[model samples]
Target: MPVTYIPPEQRKGILESPILQMAMQQRMQQQERQFRERELKLKEQEMPVKNLIQMGNLAKSLSDLGLDPRVILGTKA
Candidate 1:
């Protein structure tokens, strides 16, 4: 179904209840948050954080050898 466009000037004469507008805005924000959370989850799953321990150990070994441990930056300080 296509929506008929109502000009803003014509739309002004129509009374919109504030509660309905608020509910629509709240629904939009909720959907936006859900979308972002799904994206974050997908990215994290692609490169799981569980590797941190292994990488941190590698960094520590490098540091022990007097090398700069740049991988340490990603680990918990």
Candidate 2:
């Protein structure tokens, strides 16, 4: 492929164009918003698993102390 060299003035004009700047800003904002939404969704999905792990650890600790978790929590086997 032949590389075409653009003049410095044209390059500057293109880079400094307001329309291009606004488009770039909008795209970046949209990408950031999408990233935040995905991050929140992942955290939401992880919450139940985290709660279950915490419950298991608590139960284990209780059993180590000779406490019956099922009875204390009134959960069915």
Candidate 3:
């Protein structure tokens, strides 16, 4: 089959057709949703580490004030 050259105006019209435009919008929305999901997963993974660091800081602060961290944090039975 011989490849016929398409005129630029016809190509532009095809690109601007409503069906193609809607498809492009749907593709963009899906990509955005995937990106947000990945971002949420990363933040969820980071939360435990962030909490651990905060706890460590609080323990250190208590120790610096001459308080036993274990006693204040209720580690002893």
Candidate 4:
């Protein structure tokens, strides 16, 4: 006896077209707009964080030197 193979038919909802592609593009644009707004807000607050780091380094040097705080920041005459 020989074996016979027959392919099955695809259902109606199995494939997507151009309309679905356009909907995905719109969703991506909305997400990108929200991300850029948040990035701008974060950049505005970064300056204070940089100032704190500079101050921390100065404090460490002052404690290690065993000298007056004014002498560390002053230039040699």
Best by TM-score: 3
Candidate 4: Cα lDDT at 37? 92
Q: lDDT tens string, model 1, 1-77?
A: 99999888878654476877788899999999999999999888867565877777888898999877874465445
Q: Candidate 4, residues 1-77: lDDT per residue as tens digits?
A: 99665444542333355676678888899999999999988988997898879866886788678865456766334
lDDT of 2 by residue, 10-58 (tens): 8988888999999999999999999999999999999999999999999
Candidate 1 TM-score, C-alpha based? 0.43
- Candidate 4 lDDT (Cα, whole model)? 0.73
Residue 30, candidate 1: Cα error in Å is 0.2
Which ten contiguous residues of candidate 1 have the minimum total lDDT?
68-77
Cα shift from native, residue 5, model 4 (Å): 38
Model 3: colliding residue pairs: none
lDDT of 2 at 8: 83
2 versus 3: better lDDT goes to: 3
Q: Tally clashing residue pairs in candidate 2.
A: 0
lDDT of 2 at 46: 100
Which of 3 and 4 is ahead in TM-score? 3
- Candidate 3, run of 10 with poorest lDDT: 68-77
Off by over 4 Å in 4: 1-15, 67-77
- Count of backbone clashes, every candidate in sequence: 0, 0, 0, 0
Evaluate model 3: give its lDDT: 0.95
Off by over 4 Å in 1: 1-15, 49-77
The TM-score that candidate 4 achieves is 0.44
- Relative to the true structure, candidate 3 reaches a TM of 0.84
